[model samples]
Target: MANASARANSVTVENQDVALLKSTTVGRGPISDIAVDGDTVVTTNFGDDSIAVLDSDTLAVHGGVFAGQPTTVAVVGDRAFAAVSSASYDAIAVIDTVSGEVVKEYPLSFNVTAVVTSADGKRVYAGRSGEEGVDVAVLDVTAERVGTIYVAKAADATIDAMCLDTTGRRLYVGVTDSRSSRLITVDVETSRVRRTLEVGAPIRGLALGMEGVAYVLTSDIADGGVLYVVDLVNNKITADVAVAAAPTQLVLSADGTRAYVVDYDHVAVVDTEKRAIVAEVSVGARPSAIALGSDRLYVADYDGGVTVYTVAASTPMLYSQFASALAVPAPRELQPAV
Candidate 1:
């Protein structure tokens, strides 16, 4: 049983020809989302109802927590919040980084799809795809459920992905529909829809930039894929970039000058300023999520592994390597930043 569980957690990739950094698998399930803070990597295990905490520098499994069917994770200071979804348990699991134990669970009306923490580390905002209404729930880390904002027209809307600006005052949610899609921005304080930008497709992934610029990924399940860049200040589509088949996730660089996208079998890089495809690299099968570190991009593949790419140099190169390692740790220790 332990070997089977380990195999289920391991991820294997093809030879990338270059010296690749040994990839590490930290949990026993599909990694739906990943977030990084210094040497810590927080992952949402969609298949296991848990969050796997990993040591970024060594790629070692530190610890994790049974945070329900965690779909997303966000960290601020010594507190980590996970958006958990399940019929039996739908809530946000809050973990004190110093102890790694679940200090509290904020219940929700619907299944949680994404979660983001405030810059000040005082509040957590969660997006839910409810049966009756699509809404955003705000929780006070020190207190309990203090407020919630529901989107009426977005009641039946499916919010799969989200991102916040530097200030954490505004939230951008990606609404995916069968016929069309839209981007909904909400004011956290009032819990009201500040604006809804209608883009003409199914938007599954979202990324926010510095000057109110938003990047939206539209999935073309039948054909290839397309990326829509929206000017939030002006509320219009700025540019559209095409990508590989079935694009699933998107991430913007720290400088907000480039966008990285993951598709079924390839990763696309776009120049945000020029709004053009700059490079494309072949990766694992069915890449699900991506996270940006100081100079590298980490991709989680559905085949049970992760691929790390070096993006710092002028020409993007496949650095280290890949491996099949899996062993998600439980959340127990929360180390306060020094």
Candidate 2:
């Protein structure tokens, strides 16, 4: 238990999820996807046939470029990659966050459901799904398809979600066929399957954590949803945390302590250490996507509305505590004056 002095200084953290909420609308049509980096937030507006970039703090529209039915988006540094997968268009539209212009396009032979990038924005990995099979396309920042990794061969198998580990050496693909669902981990260097685990339900989202842990969200009609904690190093599941019945996306914090899950009408906050839900935030309507920037949480509804909140993260909280503790005047509380 903390002392009374510590209690007096108990930082009033506004979730920083699980509290402190602000709602903002970006009217561009129903949002298909959302991604945030620094002070920028990008959303793919499928119905509007464009993407919208906004200031993360003010909810002000920065600028956006038009694309042909942008489905999903990812951001690395100042660049944003949107997967445009309409009937006539199948390409990766690259945009500059500051100018909000589609500077380049990488024509793709297939449609992608998930898009992720390397830490340095040098490479983009796209999850391609079709009737034939599913594979991951390795794309360089120069708007070129470098290579492809075969993820699944089952006829009509589709990749539901794709996540790259912190080290960027491992990629996890959640694929579901007509009969079963699976989580496949692949080595980036070798471009080979490292391990495959049966999930048995539709995978909604995936996020990697510290110490080789993978958090996967699976949705079931009858069973609702379950957040499975898997040990990547041991190749086993460590815990199963329940969540919403129908979920769309999952975004984990950089510290890997909390996971924000976008369910039907709310965001479920789960504590990784406790292996339980710490809070549920009401987002209203259908939440299509979610992203995290620093301690800020961005939840985008299918209707194109986004809500922002400041969630508690390990690094920021530690710094906040230390800074506060050090600001004590004259060391009155100092023990032994040592």
| TM-scores, one per candidate | 0.81, 0.86
| Tens digit of per-residue lDDT, candidate 2, span 151-239 | 78977788889986555667799998878789999887777788999988888899877767888888888778889999888888888
Q: What lDDT does the true structure give each of the candidates?
A: 0.67, 0.76
Which stretches of model 2 miss by more than 4 angstroms? 1-18, 316-338
- What would the per-residue lDDT of candidate 1 be over residues 149-248, giving only the tens digit for each residue? 6754544678767776655556788777656788888775456688888887777678876666788888765646787878999889988877657887
User: Which candidate ranks first by lDDT, i.e. highest?
Assistant: 2
Stretches of model 1 off by over 4 angstroms after superposition: 1-19, 282-285, 313-338
The TM-score leader among the candidates is 2
Cα displacement (angstroms), candidate 2, residue 76, comes to 0.9
Model 2 is weakest, by summed lDDT over 10 consecutive residues, at 329-338
